[model samples]
Target: SDGTSLEGNVVLPDGKEVDAGEVQEPISDEVYYIAPDKCTECMGFHEEPQCAAVCPVDCCVPDDDHVETEEALLAKQRFMHPE
Candidate 1:
């Protein structure tokens, strides 16, 4: 493992910036929540989720509860890392 992960500020729905680590985690043992607001789902980096692509066991699966459209994903990408 590279021991590296994408680190950047995430824009909240209200336009506030929060550290990536500040995202809330799942409370249940059965639920692994990835912050939808923070997850661009590799929108800016690749066509697919990079973590899932590179996982040795492919354990990184999409969060069904956090379903987002492409437009939403792209908008998030721009919001979090404006150029």
Candidate 2:
């Protein structure tokens, strides 16, 4: 995982140009964002979500807009990464 290609665009929270979909670009002033379709929630990496577990303010709650099952999560992981 040391040199994995993003293969996707890293856009800003307000849809501004940040990384321009490549890692070689210098980071822009725009805040970056990860699309929900690309976010794994750390399912393949950990049992519990490290983000929610280590969040100081406990603001990493589940979103009602984007609900996914365990199977779906795994499938997504595989879909993005065919390795």
Candidate 3:
């Protein structure tokens, strides 16, 4: 694996560990995720997005092209947070 993506490490929200890499998908689909659906850009960047703050590798990056309006961000947060 001369040109392989990072693998073999993860910490779950419940503090459990998993050997996901051993049973994961192919490399082409390894480093994969959606912008609007996966991240919110921390709005003002002070309260850093939990995902970005905890990403051990810092692979997370803002998607300017997928910028969401204030209303949109809130809607997303509420959608994910629920009442």
Candidate 4:
């Protein structure tokens, strides 16, 4: 595995740019929570979720409670990254 850290541009709902490391809420020292509004499931960026693929423990499964259609996921991705 590459030693590169997972980081990227993050935009809030109010159009504020935030540090990627600060995006996920900390549940504990070893656990973090990804907000649904901030997660696009890598729809427009990859064929599948990279998180799930790269997770050593295979803990990045889909959230059935917040299931979204493909179109909706793409739309969210486009909104977050207009470039």
Candidate 5:
């Protein structure tokens, strides 16, 4: 293990034991929650996936389930940071 376990456990939806692959953790605004309502996924300011680009371990993966189109993502960015 490279100080990191590829296979690990994440808290499940029902608050029980399950495969990490089966659970979904929300992204938080205060800490990078995507704000789904704010994340342009790095819109107008970045040319790439900013979070993933900055993430040290490259652990940030696109949410296939919470998937949204580019337009939706941009809309979210506007909604979250309406400044």
Candidate 6:
């Protein structure tokens, strides 16, 4: 299968746009990194994390060491994606 690619700007709450590389370290040319502070585990958008659901290799598992409550996750989601 041909690998998929992701492209987007990392916009902050302050309205500044940043490069994806600024927020997440590049693991390699093919691998992507998720920024923990920007991740809400898809709390507000879906019942479960879509990343985990669609990951071809099942590498989007939760970080046990950085567990967060549902309320905290939702709050973060709202903060990042205000309507």
Model 3 scores a C-alpha lDDT of 0.52
* lDDT (tens digit, per residue) of candidate 1 on 8-56: 6644765766676654446677845455656788887798887677778
lDDT comparing candidate 5 with the true structure: 0.54
> TM-scores across all candidates?
0.60, 0.56, 0.44, 0.62, 0.49, 0.60
**Per-residue lDDT of 79 in model 1:** 60
| Model 4: per-residue Cα lDDT over 18-80, one tens digit each | 665654445578774556775778887898877777889877766689888888888777766
Model 6 TM-score (2 dp): 0.60
RMSD of each: 5.5, 6.9, 11.8, 6.0, 13.1, 7.0
lDDT of 5 by residue, 12-72 (tens): 2225554534444566545555434224667756888788888988777776667777777
Clashing pairs in 5: 27-33, 28-33, 38-77
lDDT of 5 at 10: 37
Q: Which regions of candidate 4 are displaced past 4 Å?
A: 1-28
* Local lDDT at 26 for model 4: 54
Report clash pairs, candidate 4. Answer: none
Give the winner by lDDT: 3 or 6: 6
lDDT of each: 0.66, 0.58, 0.52, 0.66, 0.54, 0.65
Candidate 4 lands at a TM-score of 0.62
Query: On residues 1-83, what C-alpha lDDT tens digit does candidate 3 reach at each position?
Result: 11123245544333555553554344366674544443445543347677777789988776767877777766545433445
The alpha-carbon deviation from the true structure for residue 20 of candidate 3, after best TM-score superposition, in angstroms, is 24
Q: lDDT value for candidate 4?
A: 0.66
| Candidate topping TM-score | 4
